[model samples]
Target: MDAMTPPDREAPAEAPIEALLRRRWSPRSFQDRPVPDAALASLLEAARWAPSCFNAQPWHLIVARRERETEAHAALAACLSGNNRRWAPQAPVLMLAVARTTFPQDGSPNRHAGYDTGAAMAQMAAQAVVLGLQIHQMGGFDPHRAREAFAIPDGFEPYAAIAIGYPGPADALPEDLRAREQAPRQRRAVADFAFFGGWRA
Candidate 1:
């Protein structure tokens, strides 16, 4: 992953914090514009700072820009399904988040690698919203293909790939996507998904 930082250096503040948490929502349509380099950098920077188990810092990012990095983008996006393909192209950038199991000390498996990486991704996604950007996580990619394409060695596992860009008009999206554009976020109620203490009887 290209670790590029934006020139405008300002530590992330509260607005982004709330936006990241509340305003963030996945959308199919994306404005056909290249996300500012600084914005991308800021997002990654936030991700890099996320806390990890044993400070493993296992998250790995692979970024693909539309024009400048077509080969990598295509290889990454090729793993997705047709649903994502419909409007994913409009996003200026695509990212693949990966993790390495070994921490270079012992050969033991790092159980927290995937979890830590997920934390980092959450940080990045939230920060992106603060920056007026949006992201969608996709699980439809081919792992074996991603491993070969990215030349990921034996120790590392590709966790997930994300589509990143500015939000676009829902109308511009295809009928299927457009239909769900204004749909509210669906979730099991807090009571359903959460438990007060011990496992439910």
Candidate 2:
């Protein structure tokens, strides 16, 4: 089994995170277990509270629980790249985060929709960490396939797909993934990303 104390698995941060940032870490190996409905609800509730541009709240979360939403679960699963498919399916829950590209009231372009959707997903990820679940988001999925499979409307765009569940044994993964699981997490230095008086690239 994976370590019960997930926080210990976190990479040393340049600066501390509040409430420990739930010490969140992403792992591909997930136990063959079902996420409780109550926990799932809390995750969505967390996402719902994220701030949006102009209060537009353009994110639409499409959730497919392995047990409750089988067809949807399969469709979402199918959209994953072959590598992701190997591990993501073991998670009890899968999710697609979609962004509405226009304002609901005026139909004008909402240039900030993608940013808003990201905020919502960030909130959801924090909640998952707090609840002892790890989420793995994939950009490798075919967006076109996801749109077709889910019949996503023209104005809505799929931003990311997530796999959620309890951490599983590293042995469950292929050798490459197993090595990846053990590697230290990486991030650019704060100076590289954060700037002071003026912007710096």
Candidate 3:
């Protein structure tokens, strides 16, 4: 039972910095409002500016509006476990992000592609926060089905899908979820995870 908060909160005095540090979070309850094309475009542009190794920007995004795809959306919804399926359907946009396995002119494995894609995803999510949007990254989808359904090219690997929209009422979420809706954020202290100079623990 991952916890969350109701959609209502006072915007911080400094919105941009607050959005960067405080506004970003993953919540399943999404309102059905239409996400503007310009905002979406800006989010993608932020991802485009993320750093990549050797300038090999290999992340690919395939976006789908939940209402637009009948069979596909149903299949996608079913692909997620019951809990995720509940609120994911309410999101207006779904993005399937992929990474290419080969570098141009080099047949060698592109080991860093996934890392670069992850960075781009982080940027996109952060940008969404700045734009008053919410995004949930899902690891429960059927990757094989996604590849076939989207006709993903041979070199590309389907990695993750994100559900994007505005936050919905906590009441719309399941009872178990509603209880933890306004939970506070948590993170490990820096000393716990970061090492100073050498391997002397």
Best by TM-score: 2
After superposition, the stretches of candidate 3 with alpha carbons farther than 4 Å from their true spots are: 1-18, 67-75
Q: Which regions of candidate 1 deviate over 4 angstroms?
A: 1-19
Instruction: Provide the lDDT at 188 for model 3.
Output: 60
RMSD (Å) per prediction = 6.6, 2.2, 4.8
Give all TM-scores, in the order shown: 0.87, 0.94, 0.83
* Candidate 3 colliding pairs: 4-180, 4-181, 4-182, 5-181
* Candidate 1 lDDT, 1-201, residue by residue in tens: 221122211223433444236666676778888888898889899999999877878888899998889999888878776687777766789888899887856767899999999999888877887777878887767779899998998989898878898777777977878877766555555577567986664
Model 3, 32-140: lDDT tens per residue?
7878889889889999999988878889998776666656666566556556776787788888889987886686778998899989999997788778787888887
lDDT by residue for model 2 (45-100), tens: 99899999889999997899999998899999999996898888888899999999
| TM match of model 3 to true structure | 0.83
- Ordered from best to worst TM-score, the candidate numbers read 2, 1, 3
RMSD of 3: 4.8
Residue 75, model 2, lDDT: 91
